[model samples]
Target chain A: MAVTAEEILATYEELSEIEAQFDDVETDIIRHQYNLSKDLYVKREKIVSKIEHFWPLVFEQAPMDIDEFIQPSDSQIILGALKSIDVKRFEIDTPVEGGDPRSVSIRFEFNENEYFENKVLEKKFWWRHGKDGFVGYVSEPVDIKWKAGKDLTNGLLSLAKAAWEEEQTASKKEGKEKKELTPKQKELKEKLDAEAATGAESFFCFFGFIGERVSAEENIEALKKEAEDRKKRQAGEKVEDDDEEMKEDEDDEDWEDEEDLDIFPQGDTIAMAIADDLWPNALKYFTQAQESDDLSDDEDDEDEEGDEEEEDGDKPSKKHKACAHGCKH
Target chain B: MAVTAEEILATYEELSEIEAQFDDVETDIIRHQYNLSKDLYVKREKIVSKIEHFWPLVFEQAPMDIDEFIQPSDSQIILGALKSIDVKRFEIDTPVEGGDPRSVSIRFEFNENEYFENKVLEKKFWWRHGKDGFVGYVSEPVDIKWKAGKDLTNGLLSLAKAAWEEEQTASKKEGKEKKELTPKQKELKEKLDAEAATGAESFFCFFGFIGERVSAEENIEALKKEAEDRKKRQAGEKVEDDDEEMKEDEDDEDWEDEEDLDIFPQGDTIAMAIADDLWPNALKYFTQAQESDDLSDDEDDEDEEGDEEEEDGDKPSKKHKACAHGCKH
Candidate 1:
């Protein structure tokens, strides 16, 4: 039996009502979450500003090289420090003026990964909208091969890298199942992929500005392109009617499935670093500074240790000496 | 120390970049999920349409009353069958010509529920968006007081009703936590809540149509109003700056959180009912129809029992007689 037009109309009306209900509720929930995250970001920013004030002074005075601080090596505890060398670009992708961009992001990746074995953090910056501005989220680390003959120094990184490399090779040998596409469609898809790959690479070339960061104008242009390219990709997904790009970004999708709207990016790395690795030393420094005001006691245990190590000769390297002296001036 | 304007801009830009990256990836994931859900909805709809073809015929001829089919009373197993009485109306909310409506919902609820204790199934049709139109979802029963002297038939309902009534009285006595709000805001909130409550109550007055269903125009207008009301409430939540509405529609939020873009509301009650309660009888009917072709055997023991009971001078009541006959057509 043929379905009546009336039945179709009735069904449509009901569906609209439901959609209205859900959209209204969801929008409110997301906005509320955003506001909460924003408030948190402000609190975090204050701590970060204080760290920024002191970090340069500490780096200048401490008997340790900049390379040691930035290297992706084990420090006897956590995996390693992940740093954002620079904000290569950013943009809000929304057509409506003043409408909050549902999609906001920043792009940055590890500038050096000499210690990493199995994977490299992708050069692409992952981001999410936060209350004050955009916040950075960690994208899944991309699998990679070591530059031939590069030595691995971190045990955990070596193990994970080897496993990932093995998986990659096996998968490559098995190959993707081929689907027949018209030459024109295949060419267009290849073009789009190549453009995206090229964009990702040139997005943060370090030598272009002769050791200085890219100018603000260049950064803004890059941000615009990133937004435009993403828009194009979305359009492509809808049009391709094919399945090539379907397999791309599966990890990112899985991550999204596991997370909720409340999972905003916490963009203050200085605050994160202070919490993660610097708190103990910072507390010790403050305690000593306060005690020294009342009386000069035997609070210079680290300095004494450094002096003893120095008497034992050049065997105690700068890093060891810095550690012994508590890297405090 | 003070934060420089440049430093703030740099931080904001970095944050924006990270957010952009995440938003792009998430949007792609959600769109993919939506496409998958749409496909599933289409497949489910085909199966439902086939079931719809035969159900009305069976219900017309079968020895069960419409009331028996729709009532919220337990028979042998399972919750009572809640169904769509009709797809009463539909309209696109968008003003743009031929633009699909953002809101469409079917109205339906359980016809009766004397068995529920703490809650009763309110006569409100909960709806979901369907691929081609609208689908009805089962709403939980509402709470009600029985007319002062109504007899309770179901033991479970009686127990629940008493407990719910007690809770209501206690809460009413306790009073709500006071919040400071402008008199105008307070009045507006009260107006909105009262409107929503009233809409919930009369949304499904079956007798108002005088045995016929409500007109499509009325349903369309009602849907428009519901959509408008929801939008206003969301605005209210933002303005009220209070937590009063924070607890509202938590279930809907949980449902949204649980479901992905691939989640579409399945709208066919005929399909739901057949799967739930009618399968055994339907199978038996098909099997008997096949057997009667080969031989005329008095295989229906229940039908024979029904004949005997009828001859015994009105001893078996209507319900018992129906049960004896297997309620078969």
Candidate 2:
């Protein structure tokens, strides 16, 4: 049977759900790959479209939306990788636009102005605060300034809103299915819950040696500033200028988008980037001079400058004579 | 009890004696970690360093030297990872630097041209002879190119030399102390060796698929150019020409090290880029305000805004909402 574009669209949504929220990492990934490969070659071209249009982008950041809170994916805990790159983001030069769920970036103002620098780190929503008398972690924050701009990543928001709607609708439709409990049991449950919720100590403290957590916001700000300055100086060669141009171009693109844009093909940036990174070493084989000719001449080619290495039982060469005035070669 | 660097180094040299090669996926990175952790911070720090420095500088458009070969690590594959970054180069960079004898980076290449562009598709090194088939892999070029820049990294070549000596000496000592084998057994061993050598086609091909296998150099280069251009275009603003005065003014700070310009940091550029990529989400967390706080201020603070999330239940109005409609209270 012909797999329609509609089925691919449905599959995309289903696969995204399985990938993002489905709790089992391996299972979700397997399901995602299976779906991807099933129509792998067939709808391959459309994935790029989906990614390009994944705007009014949805970002995963901050405390769960109330619905997500009540029934969070168990897998969400493991995915709390504190550090993750939206690998796709590196590949696309799309302007930073606004209006998406979890699109916040953090800006920490140091309590001590010594750490202050005009810097911004654009990223997803996150939180960190000190709790205990002993300082440890002053959590990093996620800023949401992007939304104030042209508000383009709304597609991501609508997706979140739709999920929210489903959560709300699900809550409404399938509720009242709870069993009636005795007063004593309810009392015990509430007490347990209260104790859990009201636990005095906070875990977010930036713990380490003493004074490490003190004015951690300042320290973090200082580090962030340092990091930010370092980047601007490095990419400063062209980034800021490019950033403005990119944003303007995006605004122009948005003018043409007229609110609705297709997303399937664009989502395949992940696929495209993968293809790009893997083909090089593969190419060496195709590009090599016939080994019968080349490999024969180069069997012991490594014995010259300074790097001598060992392979299994064979010695490639003592070619790198710099390792202590070597003459044994 | 003393753990001086020299003693620790000597102990590490001895440890490689029992370290037989494995042809399976790593069930334990901890083991490699434990073995290579003589310079724990050094090793871990080097992973990022290897990625930042040697990758772009040496391997990006370099030719294969054919003399370098890496013993596979526990997970000897980074087959389709050319999309964002290639962990495949792990072996060459690690060995080239000789940071850790136990651990090796998976082999990866930039297609001599293609780097991170496609979503990983096929990563196998093959040659259509138009006559004879299947040219073997020669990672020597990557190693040679990688080594060419070793002086830029600290003591990495020295460490590699140390490892080579340790391995060579250990192998020699073992050979000297070995027991004699019977003629039939010797013949069997010889046969096995030939078979193992003969059996390497699949192994190398597998390596081609897993590690060295990659896309065309042109494809990756084009993709990178496209990605970089797109990135610039997405983020590009019209560059205002810098006034020579302002450029000179910024240059006025003239640090003493600037005089010693030859030793300026190379890895710092990619390092900053990496940190740039990592900083966004961290920034967001620091910026978002607590939605629960606002809800509590509006009504009773004690209810905790329906923390249970009422899974499969009615949507409670009091439920906590985070980052909604521009982080509205």
Candidate 3:
């Protein structure tokens, strides 16, 4: 039996309602993520400030090298029970009075369970110019324990997946009933897929924050290698045909990364995007990326343009580093 | 024992955390509200279009006046099961070809549960400029049912009140322990109180919607009456002292409405405001409003300016009307 266009519209409406139901859950999870992120920031800043202050006072009476004095082992008593760590290094961009520019390394330890799933026990240790002996600070805005990013992400993904499945089932039923779908129905189906895809991607992108940029960079590196192989093949080098097939697989994965990066270049929480009624806006982005894929002949130039932007102070993202005093790897 | 500034800051942070936990529930409630508002808009449009089409062809031979044909009883049969009603009147702003510009009256009905809480069974009826009879149309974007605004509000208010109580108890305990409070502690206490007040106000403002605006208008009217009495007293006119005392009670109530209207002048979903990190922004608005109130000796001129803005079509809100067909008052 052929379904009427009106029926298609109804199906579209039903699909939207399903998606909208997830809006609440998605928003909740995002809020949780935001709170955690904010806590991390405050904790980091407080510890960093303390380390800065602790350095000058301790060295006032004893003339010791700032770099050597701050070691992980030296601060082992101060740091107490160790937790997960994020290490960071900073350089003095310009030396005061033309003195040689110096650098420092810092280590941040969060309570294993707390850092991973709860908001408790965050410690920061700092070592200047070397990774060793450390001094620590305890930060504020603390809590006993709360749900971690992973837990929130899992919850978000569950709701999002359910929404996607509901929409997909409705869309599939419409397609099976009607041998040929109306243009509007076809459009609706495409939009439902986009919404679902973006919904899932949002969770993945948000929770996997630092990982996403790293993956995109990795994808580009793989693409560059693949391009080199193609050039070698064209130059009549004896490259195995099996190598070409592997390259093709890598190409598909690269496209996924590219689409992910393009969809959320700035890496904003997907929950916020959905809350702002931005599905249509996100669809527009997907459309642009799809068009760009069709015009892949210009890929090299596009990569070159991205490189230029990076050179113009467009860093991939701000990385949160764990400062550990004195234990050089 | 006096509470130190550090202790005060800790209290403030705790209060914020309490409110932040409500963010998820509030967002859920707001999303529900958005869905209801969207449904209302869609249903109204569908019914109006149906009535417009139904009128012309059915009475072409008799050629009766449109207003005369549309009656409440006629639409009553077509609309059948009445649930709840929202009435509206539409006027042709411009007369076509210099003829008399006509108007129409429309009545919307939803299932009683549907209207307030459920999102089911919405039907619309309308009578032309000449209401002799009425015709009906079932609207689009239909759903079986949904959670009502009242339930959402009640749930929100419950959580908000809990958060408020917890913070209040904490603050009081600290105050009791420390007989004297530092200036910073005083400021923190004030801010926590403000957050609690705003949180409660947000839920009330959202649920009250149009009623809030009406209340604000009513407050202004009362304020004007109180001012008139004050002027009479200054002029040595015979004004009853008891009347002046009664007016003071009304004056305080009016001030509350005035503050509410000022704080959320747009009547936006408070949940969204918080999610967007707009609490600080809203606080800034409150401060500015307080300053304005202090400089409000020239309030009459401000009212006149507001009237001019309204005349210039600067009314910030869209107004809905009550439509009456064959029913007498």
Candidate 4:
């Protein structure tokens, strides 16, 4: 039998209610799992800290989702000065209302390196419900204090940061109005756009990630309004402004397209890969590195054991040894 | 500092213990989610049974993972007589020991159709821990009992079943010995192998899925013995028969390669897509179908509403209507 449009729409509304329940249960599961993993992660950190070259090796064997962003220069910096990495669901125990337990913070500690001044850099992602009826993690732009001529992002981060600041300033001055850029700003923006088109930014540019192009507070408010509107519609109330709603949807789609052209277009995906896959499976990655190294050693007929003592003595040799084995470093 | 091979090996052992703990937690989470979804799924089935063309429309919008296996002929059968589909975690509430809560059974109910004798065809997949240290679902070949000259699998299933029965008989008589096929059996086997090489089979061949070459009982016993051996090795006890173990590993690899050459090589993946993704997300797929249909109606400038009454009266027109919109049917 042919299904009427009305029946389809009604069924969709019913399904949406069921989906919402499923989503709630999923959130609860995540919150519980996050709490359970906390102590285990702490135990893991203690065991991993004493292991030499742990972080570098883990990064080297990271899955393609995360590895694709790491440039040779980025690998050099990582192999040379990257000390350790930590991931935590920072909001899991938060007592604050509206806090999402799934929001995570990824911390990278580095030794004295040529890249940046900061010894510890932490990037926090806030899991929020989007206005477009999707849930994802959003993050603010993190400023990395790069040393002179040591920016692995090739000045793209600085350019993006400036443009973001200008956008923020303009938004504050004139709500929801597009701001015209000055000549210098326009030139910098053009250069940034061109660099973004190439899509070969360093992994360090992950620090400059600003997902969603909107603040958390603004997103939460918009989602709340949308929810209220949905409830009103469900209660058999006619929602006016259909044309305005269509225009808003089109605008949102355009913004999403623009977001896709950013340097770190898949920032959320990368963040998820790091937080979910790379961090939890670090030990597996480390083991994989060891296994691959062993295979290559056998193939090359190299005395890697004899070189181990030299690697322990000189830090530079460790980098060289990794590079000799076809590592990006 | 350079990590020694001993240290890497020791770390891997420690990490494996941590991973096992994580797995336990994951299993518990899945059990809880499964129980919670049971009632919701029941409610969904009740609602869906009243909707016309529900199963066909949902299948039409299925993701590529599942859709890729479905042939045009399979689509015709589905759109013609498929009444409803149901997925259940059959082993979840089983009182038997070693019952896995994750094991699922997918049931497809059909109206009086030209394909098969049975009104309902159910395929069950058992979630098990493999001897190779990976956990996956395994299923036995399900008999479709197709009507004469109406077999969708083109006699492939029948040939496979006969070959499997012969293997079983041979194994019973001469434990682990290679089975020899009869001259007539060899011809059928050659035809089956050729069909498998083409990598084009009816979706009905999913009923003939036997995921792992080894029986579940054998796998479980092997895993238990391996675990015991690992414990002994960790305690500095030398286990002999290194060459035998290497040979067994090679044999297992060969078996895996042979399994990959089957008609439904990705049976586990397809089963997962059905149970986890397609079944749970049926409402989403149905909505997608309706939305896509609306878009096509607008593009074609056709009065789908005027034709709806005719579709309600005639079953074949529903298939024609779907085909008109570029569906495989």
Judging by lDDT against the true structure, name the best candidate: 4
Cα lDDT of model 2 by residue, A166-194, tens digit:
43354345443432333332343344345
Give the alpha carbon lDDT tens digit for every residue of B187-229 in model 4.
Answer: 5557777776776689988887776654668556755755675
TM-score of the second chain of model 3 compared to its true counterpart: 0.19
Enumerate residue pairs that collide in model 4: none
Tens-digit per-residue lDDT, A222-317, candidate 1: 345434533544443211211223225222222121221111112123222332223213322222322332233444554665444333321111
| Candidate 3 residue lDDT tens string, B83-131 | 3333222213222321111111223344343213432332211111111
Count of clashes, each model = 44, 110, 39, 0
CA-based DockQ, model 1: 0.01
DockQ of each: 0.01, 0.02, 0.01, 0.13
Q: Estimate each model's TM-score.
A: 0.24, 0.17, 0.18, 0.78
Candidate 4 positional error at B254, Å: 9.9
Q: Which ten residues in a row have the lowest lDDT in candidate 1 chain B?
A: B315-324
Interface RMSD of predicted model 3: 26.4
Find the candidate with the highest TM-score and give its number.
4
**TM-score-best of 1 and 3:** 1
Model 3 bad stretches (over 4 Å): A1-251, A255-267, A270-329, B1-329
lDDT (10s digit) by residue, model 4, range A1-329 = 67787665566555555665666676788787777777888878776786778889989877776888788999999999898888877778664445676688889999998889999988888877554443567776677889998888887777666766765666567655443553434655577677767876788888767766546675567557646755865785543423335446646333323453255656777788888778876765675576567656664655665444333321110121112112221
Error of 4 at A114 (Å): 3.7
Please report, as a residue range, the 10-residue window in candidate 3 chain B with the lowest summed lDDT: B320-329
User: Candidate 1 lDDT (Cα, whole model)?
Assistant: 0.29
Q: What would the DockQ be for model 4?
A: 0.13
Span of ten consecutive residues with least summed lDDT in model 2 chain B: B127-136
The list of candidate 1 runs beyond 4 A from truth reads A1-79, A83-114, A117-329, B1-80, B83-108, B113-329
